[model samples]
Target chain A: MSAERYNRQIILKGFGEEAQQQLLRAKVLVIGAGGLGCPALQYLAAAGIGHIGLVDDDTISLSNLHRQILFTTADIGKLKVEVAAKRLQEMNTQIGIIRHPIRLQKNNILDILSRYDYILDGTDNFESRYLINDACALLNKPLIFAAVSGFEGQLAVFNTPDHLTPSTNYRDLFPIPPDKGEVANCAENGVLGVLPGILGTMAAAETIKLIAKIGQPLTNKILSYNLLTQEQYTIKISHGGGYTLPKTVDEFLNMDYQDTSEGPQGYAEIDASELVKLQQLESTILIDVRERHEVPILDKQIFTQVPMSEFGAFMSKEFYQKHVVLICQHGIRSVAAAEAMQEKYGDAKKIYSLKGGIVKWRDHFLKP
Target chain B: MKIELISFGKISEFINNQNIEVDGIADTDTFKQYLENQFPALKSMKYKLALNKNIVQENTEITNNAIIAIMPPFSGG
Candidate 1:
């Protein structure tokens, strides 16, 4: 460890050589490299954390540049872990930066988390957060949790390994994950560029405090902040029920943290190219389920316009022997339409939905 | 008694105004019922309620001029 690099933090009243050494020996794993993970990784690296892990399967895109500060425009299309680990290493050569350019699934979470002393959840969804919480709880590893949306953010430290007293986990705060599309994320709803920076740094601060024993960490309490009004506060969170987390690796593997798409079962999903192949057949039919006003309309006259609102009306009067393909703005509503048609038409007609709808069709086949 | 209701994040979209003044509400439970009745959309949202900046899990009595904060879980980074 270079004494000159971390001299500023070393000079703080009680945070001296011993605390610096503690940081030098600690191992922390950050789950995502986008938004919050970028700033937390940077600050942790600058503070001389000895070992850090970066985990993300996503690649850098133009949209992520506003908040994911570690990546530059030139790094677009590169894996996030690859880009983040390189940047972190350039900043602090003494630290060990492990790059796991893969999504954290049930099969690998324990193997990855067992190697680290602490885990930082920078994932942008409830599924990953809940999975991390359960795995950390079972492993007795402390987790630093943080999330940001729009102008507000939340932070908490959970599973601190203090068994004598009760501690709260994410499940205690939220017993179950919200329904799909119930909570809007930064992608659907806009987020202020600087909000994640502010919250991610706070998460890093908590991690350092826990590692170095510097200050009171935000354990068993959640801190909420709103950047729009600059109002911030912390509230105590308690376990509501006597809920037990998965004890064995097998149990954890069986847990379903993500909300699976509840589209109709046994439905065929055809890609744009596959649809084109099927279009050559004389009996193939395409039904546009989107509203008539929707843009990027299909120029092919063979496509019948049957908006979802009037799907029931169209089904009542028309009976066709042709192979049917349903399409909407996105594949979600189209899947539902396919399910409804299957219930009415049964196996009499072969049905399919365009896998990603017209937007994907345009991207793959129409774009020049 | 009158209490000031403040909502945050996506829950604010369901409420007509960010801050609402409710009269004749004596407890958090009734206030929650009133909110659900007024904004049916809020019934589906996952959130926690804070009274005077303190998170109260049980139905606590609402005092005069108290501030109740309605906060929804934010799953973004």
Candidate 2:
């Protein structure tokens, strides 16, 4: 009968038939199918989650195959949604899937998310993470989030609708963004083959735990996993950090939503390029907050490259050390890097990520 | 000490031949004020500012030692 479908999971003391059935009936939406989303979607669909929504707006890149396991070599150049949907459909034909092939923008997210009960965030950068958090916050939906950097991975859930437990978001975790050149990303810093595998599996675990109402959710806790040592630790987020979450999607998208506890002015930032050549020479440390693997790194001898993930472990001093210039694959990680460093460093100036990142640099200085 | 500015990628026409400076503005003035005095068009350009190398808001005070750089909000992924 149906008992055989979930025989193993149902054997758990607390997660018996009822929990399995709960998972079978739950509707979960997994946004992003890259590194983190790949594994998260696999387990949920395999577990026969009643209805699943797979959303993404990307194509298969030769670069993605290292961690994105859903696609094969022949699947290259195909739409991610098309390929991912095909794979999920095969995983569990009995389950329902609502495929969204478009990028997860604020406009389309609400309607798509209104019907789902649980949301999983496997996105890499901060913009999507913030948009997802704000949208779910206002909608009062339960969200499971997981992000990994080098050896570190973080997981949490935000349920703003729950009156008793106001959720903590990425903003709450790192109140201010890091300056440019303060952090690194998997794209630039080489991620071990199993890093995303380890993290994505954790995300899948959290999704099911939330759906099945199991023993405990990573709801109020921030779980950090270090693959280098196989050590996992959890930090409880405190409330009331004076950060006012954005009220509307526009507010979130306007790029004005800032976390500024670290800067002398907090999240307030300036363009590093505006400082004239003489100014840069006078008093500033132009640190590049990108991973070393990013090709054609910035050429200025004045600039230093420090990956964002490792920034937390370094920088034991105050913020605004030497007018840092953070950069990354694009600008998303740099913004997150800025906020993370800003929140942690807590005060100084001369820290700004390149507005468009090194790609802009490549186009400007070295472009053909 | 004066704050100098430069840009890459796509350059706006306003960038050329403009030697803009605001007098009586110390390094301690917030970058937003610097924009108000130097590039009036940039005031509404919706750009972000930074000293040394970090992004800063409009009201941040200018510091003599700060290396101010003005740029736009990040949109690329």
Candidate 3:
């Protein structure tokens, strides 16, 4: 390792060459290269972490520029892990940056997490948070957790033993995941650019402290910060009962970490052309989930209006169609409708949502 | 008996982020029910209650003037 690159941290009173060496030998994997992951990865790489693995399946979009500082405007449409790895590598060439451009599923999570000594969870959804937490607990890996919503953020270190307790995972706090749509994410509730920045940086700090054996890390404790009031508080977490944690690998695999907020779990999102093609098939039904007063109307003969306001009543009636396609104005509500249909039909019928919604396919709907 | 209540994250939307004077709630279980009735929105939300900065795993007695924090899990990155 180059002493010249890390001279500042090496010369610190508590952090000497020995601590720097610990950082150099550390292997940390960060999930989700969005707001929290971006900042955490940057600082972790800059601190001269020897090996860093980044996992993300999303592509950079224009809307992510404000908080996801790793990507540039020109880098839009590029894969997030690709761009983030490139930028982090540029920040510190001495360290190794590994990019896993894939989403974390139950099957793939264990294999990927086993390679890293420490796991940092910066994912944006409940599905990933619970999955990573369980895997880290099962593998006995120290986890640095960070999340943000609106003007507030949370930071915690999990699965690492402290003086008073064995260890505490996220489930110690919230035993079970909330129902779908009960809680809103950053996309639904907007956040300031600096909220995740502060939380992500703190997550990196906790990781570094854990690696270097510096001052006490946030083990068995969770910190909450409010940007609006500039006030923060830390609460002690204890082992909570009433939650079932998978004990074995088979149990973990069998556990369902449902994707609650993103979209319909077990359905397909098709485009306008695919919708047209399905119209030719027998026993195919197209549903418009928009409100009665909204937007351009489609042909009544082909389209069936089932407004979301009265969807509960519509769901009680049985339909014999084999293929059910749901559509909305912006594609957001259609996903919600698809989720409901998936819950009702299960594997008995095929469910699909119109990608980009009717607004994007106005011409196709308006024609004829 | 009175208790001080604080909220964070999405739970803050339902409960104001200040010390609230709660009365007649002897335990965490009853306090939770009281909160749900007071703010009907809290019924659907999931959160953890910390009494005096310690997360309560089970129903614990609420002392007078004890600080209670309601924290909701944030899914955003």
Q: Which ten residues in a row have the lowest lDDT in candidate 2 chain A?
A: A257-266
lDDT of candidate 3 over A5-73, digit per residue (tens): 999999999999999999999999999998999999999999999999999977776668999999999
TM, chain A, every candidate: 0.74, 0.67, 0.78
Candidate 2 displacement at residue A274 in angstroms: 25
Q: Which candidate would rank higher by DockQ, 1 or 2?
A: 1
Off by over 4 Å in 2: A160-165, A179-182, A185-187, A248-368, B1-77
Better of 2 and 3 by lDDT: 3
Better of 1 and 3 by DockQ: 3
What's the true lDDT of residue A257 in model 3? 88
For model 1, residues B1-77, the per-residue Cα lDDT tens digits are: 66677777777666633455667788989988998898888897888888887676778998888888887877788
Candidate 1 residue B25 Cα shift, in angstroms, is 4.0
The alpha-carbon deviation from the true structure for residue B46 of candidate 3, after best TM-score superposition, in angstroms, is: 0.9
Best by DockQ: 3
- Each candidate's interface RMSD: 1.4, 10.9, 0.7
TM-score between candidate 3 and the true structure = 0.81
TM-score order of candidates, top first: 3, 1, 2
TM agreement with the true structure for every prediction: 0.76, 0.57, 0.81
TM-score of chain B of 3: 0.88
Model 3 stretches astray by more than 4 angstroms: A185-187, A259-368
Identify the CAPRI category of the predicted complex in candidate 1: medium
